[model samples]
Target: MRQLNKFTFNICPTVSIHNQINLLSNEDIKYTFNDFQKNKQIISCVDNFSEIERDECHIYFCPYESKEYHKITNNFPGGIFIHVHEIALFDEQPFEHKSFFQISQSFRFMKKLTLINDKRSRKLHDNNEHLSIIKYPHLSQLDLSEAQDDYIEQFLVDTKTCLPNSFYLCCRLSSTEKSDTTLCKKYNMNKLFKSAFVMFNCIFQGLSLFDRRFNQLRVLHVNSSWIRYSSRLTINNTENLPNLKCFSLYCDTDTVVYDELIVPLLHRMLDLEKLHLYLIIGYKNTFIDGNNLKRNIINHMPPLNIFTFNIRTTVHLHNLN
Candidate 1:
């Protein structure tokens, strides 16, 4: 009673990890798992355990409706089990890669993840190879947008998962460049995909608007009839987009998606800032000519600030009746 046996966790070091922790009828989670054995990264959750009743400093859990799985307890030292930060892996089955490497070792300081399994995972197409590569070293933010697509080839296919560095990904599939005609397998979908967040009717199939392997692409919104038939490529692979700023295209008629692939992909994005087009060009009419739209795309984007255009042109051949 003299301060309960001299316990001073610097004054309640935040201990609340329950959703299933009985610890033999829970005496305040067995005195908060024996003062967390002298601090273990202030564990918030998921240290991945389902068996630990040793009673002398081993209380890992899995109590609710327990079917038990992991047995963690070598007197503690598997990196004291990573402190779970934030993880969301909703399932209705199908989650292979050994349940994503046991949730990357029970959420090792996971940053922010949200996956809503759409069911696939046949060992991600059965070439298991002893499955390893699943690491989430302080992951940034990853929402699979209702995942499926084998979880986008199981985390951008860098042999299965190892993302970081500005890592922020939100997904919502589309063609996914299924034919491989210069999609280069979506540049293996990872080279930091510039913090990817694709899916505006996403269709960049048959590559066109520049790709020095996505040269750290910034942002591109496409759906202009599948990019007006491969948006006129071949000017040395459309020169330098140099980390394209931000762009959008939403054509429905296409006089070649605005004077030939949106003015040669906006003169190779000379560091474009932002521009959105809702073009419907077809009657040609030179894109409402204003000195050829200021010498072809407002003077080659001197760092365009923000310009939205709906300056349309259409005879609406209406997709040929």
Candidate 2:
């Protein structure tokens, strides 16, 4: 490790980005790179990061308190691209949307980013569900393990930030030592590829944790009511488990219809050839008729071969003579 000479600089709080996909207004890249100072702590730069211990290769901007402590400026530059791989942002100040934009401007290829702020986020002006979303195109792991309440809204809120496609963010206690799978997926992480998921004993909060589709999954059996997110899968842009061939869900009693929860879930199984549903359904506005199966569910799953379901629906006849 070569001696890292500390260079000081200053950076604007908010940077304007034009090409940031799914983000704010398009106006060419208006970000500027100013020179580093001799004796200041506004912005800091040290470019000796290389896999093989080289010089002036990877630039890492990590801002802290002064809203300038972490900005990675390129003074001794080989090229414009700053290859910051791992970053740990520690600050006492509350992080706002601008804080992310500043990071996103330079760390386009950052793999692992850790945020260490306990304070909440201050909402930006005109913040809404339809606002431009800040996207991290190549970021694979974001360790919000030390973030807090306002961080959830700043990161998880659909309108604020956009992670990679099929990205699933899970939050467990940082102290807990268990790895739980997403709602739609549960595979052994140690084993890269898994074919079947069969659990007829324990009931999980069905579809509540399902975020991404399982393409390699062929069989899934669960003892679950399977009613949550029945109306939200499509809206959330959840793709189908395309390769699933067999699915069996058994529920003791549920008040959901085939249209709402059951069929919407089945529609995701594009390649499913066999299905078995044991459901005791009651008190729904609509009953599961043959057409409901044929048009709503079956029509979507083109390769469906054997369709079997035991459903009982109780309907109330009103104003009968």
Candidate 3:
């Protein structure tokens, strides 16, 4: 005689497939929703998925389905993992499903989740209220530079866990914004841009809006465009970051004001230990040269007995590629 043990459970989707064979009989297997008129148990199965033990299930689906599973598993030990590609399939459900309130309730338990794709569903997941429950001490790594700024910013805001000690971010501003480039009349493009100075000021303002989550940041990197926008003006409250120790900035062009903006900001970062900068082009031939840039910044930034400052300038090359 074979004895079945109740505690030995298979919670993986692959294992669930095998269970489906036993749980659903030949008659029930034949009744797909498309042919449900012939048999009603399939609909009963879909509607009453809760009848299964909370600890005996695992679901694999896109963000929306993952969100639904989160709602169902809040009391269960394991959480759901999102698959970015299949989200649209769940989203394409007949109009009735879109209006279903049960789906919304199902998403309310979504927390401590890992987003798997660059899709908008990932963005929506970041905004979910349950995100703050994410346990930071257990987090191994996170890569957010490729994510949209709105998602990236909100994720940091919702992050209750200290950021991992090491990570990589490759952030670049969108090049097509009329405000960053030129004015145009055909698309009312000039109005589209809020003006470079205003956009620049907003970068400085964002630091204030940056929530206390920044206290966990130990190392920070910024591309030239981020500097162009965020460095256009210096922020005043940087002293709030108690753990910050290293900073790096890449500049598109050698601009003296970059130093001006950075010096004052660094003055507030007392724990700063190392600073590095890469410039695409050396300072525009003018009164300020590398020597002046070094002297002026050293006078205002946080004191450093041992640190490395290196600058690389690039020039237009002929067809090496």
Highest lDDT among the candidates is held by which one? 1
- TM-score top scorer: 3
lDDT of 2: 0.50
C-alpha lDDT score of every prediction, in listed order: 0.56, 0.50, 0.36
Better of 2 and 3 by TM-score: 3
After best superposition, candidate 1 residue 229: deviation in angstroms? 23
18-78 per-residue lDDT for model 1 (tens digits):
5335533334545556655354433222233223212322333322122221322222223
Every model's TM-score: 0.28, 0.37, 0.40
* Clash number by candidate, in order: 0, 6, 0
Off by over 4 Å in 2: 1-193, 197-206, 225-237, 317-321
Off by over 4 Å in 1: 1-101, 106-135, 138-165, 168-170, 173-194, 202-296, 304-321
Candidate 2: Cα lDDT at 221: 58
Q: Per-residue lDDT tens digits of candidate 3, residues 15-38?
A: 233345456432353343344233
23-49: candidate 2 lDDT, tens digit per residue: 322121112223433333232233332
Better of 1 and 3 by lDDT: 1
